[model samples]
Target: MSQSASDQSDRTSPVKTQSPLILDSLPDIPGVEDCSLRVQQKIDLILLAIEALELGGSEYMLATAKELELQSIVDNRVALWRMRCSNPWRRSHVRTRLTLKQGKALTLIASYRARQLTVLIRQLLVAQQQIQEKGLPLEQHFRLSDYLERFRAHFRSRMNPRRAKVAVYLADENQLNDLALSLLSQLLFCTGTYGLKRLWVSLFDGEVA
Candidate 1:
């Protein structure tokens, strides 16, 4: 075999030995939501490197994040989150403090549900605009997610099937079984440029059909 082929054949990395994060913890990989396989692999590598720096502290963490260009993503939300969760700052939130259990729960939620939550927040922005246009007639009880559902139905009928399907696929990342697609049109209409970027990423995640 050739030198490259011989090296590839000899390599055998065990799954059990792989780490959860790349560095001391997770670096901001904002593009993971819409990344190519190569980009996704690099994200995994960043996580691993962060995991390895578990005891490296904030200075080292920020330094590494800067080195990796993590701040360039999402106005540095991930980098700022890491900084807030680090020493001195973690215990004193500008918003409020939480118990260890609450903190753990939130961390878990952010890890898996960040995209969902961001979409929800963006949806609320859309609902707010509608409310502004409608003038004063505030309901005593209202649910924005309901508005998202209704808006999707109206928007879907107005859109071509191909375009609508593409929007639905992008919104839910091809989760056909999930009702999240009902918010597709609203999501794109509200979240602006980042939402467009997220939609592009969805295509990479196999949303294109």
Candidate 2:
């Protein structure tokens, strides 16, 4: 094999042995580049939700990368920030396309973290359900309220308020909270079996023809 191919193999070897949750690679879907924008946005949001769920989330993300043996792609905090900034919605958006390999690494890290936080995620979801069933506001439950508040704060600080899409979310508290809840549900999905593969495919839903 070529040096690049051999190096790639060496990199993935650890992931296979590190955890059952780690995927060697995602399927080679056509037109992935065209869909990368959407993929980047979803990935960033997933991580953002995770950050909201826990204090010092960025640090956890870096540590998770090391724990998952995905540092070759994630590298460090600056690299992580650059990858996330690829999201066009960010205030410090960087014009870069997320490579398939980088996306897979992030998916693995996200699913693994989601699994670790499964109990808390379930509790939050249940609280959300109870709140909706009683027609009560989100803040009625303290933990859920805290998570939603953190999500909104992160969104406001990182997302560019000048953008039209972001302005709508900034103006409407309900709309933004709904997005946070939706992401919370997605995190729950990530904790399930084959969750990484499921999210991998879903990322290209519309772009793949």
Question: What are the lDDT figures for the candidates, one per model?
Answer: 0.33, 0.84
Using TM-score as the measure, the top candidate is 2
Q: Write the per-residue lDDT of candidate 1 for residues 48-158, one digit (tens) a residue.
A: 222222232234444544443333221244534542332221122233232222222222222222233346545455665686577833231164434434434433432
**Which regions in candidate 1 have their CA more than 4 angstroms from the true location?**
1-18, 21-111, 117-119, 137-141, 144-209
Tell me each candidate's RMSD, in Å, in order: 18.4, 4.5
* lDDT string, candidate 2, 79-138, tens digits: 999999989899999999887767887877888889889999999999899889999988
Measured on C-alpha atoms, candidate 1 has an lDDT of: 0.33
Q: Estimated TM-score per prediction?
A: 0.22, 0.88
> How far off is residue 198 in model 2, in Å?
0.6
TM-score of candidate 2 against the unseen true structure: 0.88
Local error of candidate 1 at residue 56 (angstroms): 31
The 10-residue segment of model 1 with minimum total lDDT is 14-23
* Model 1 / residue 20 / CA error / Å: 1.9
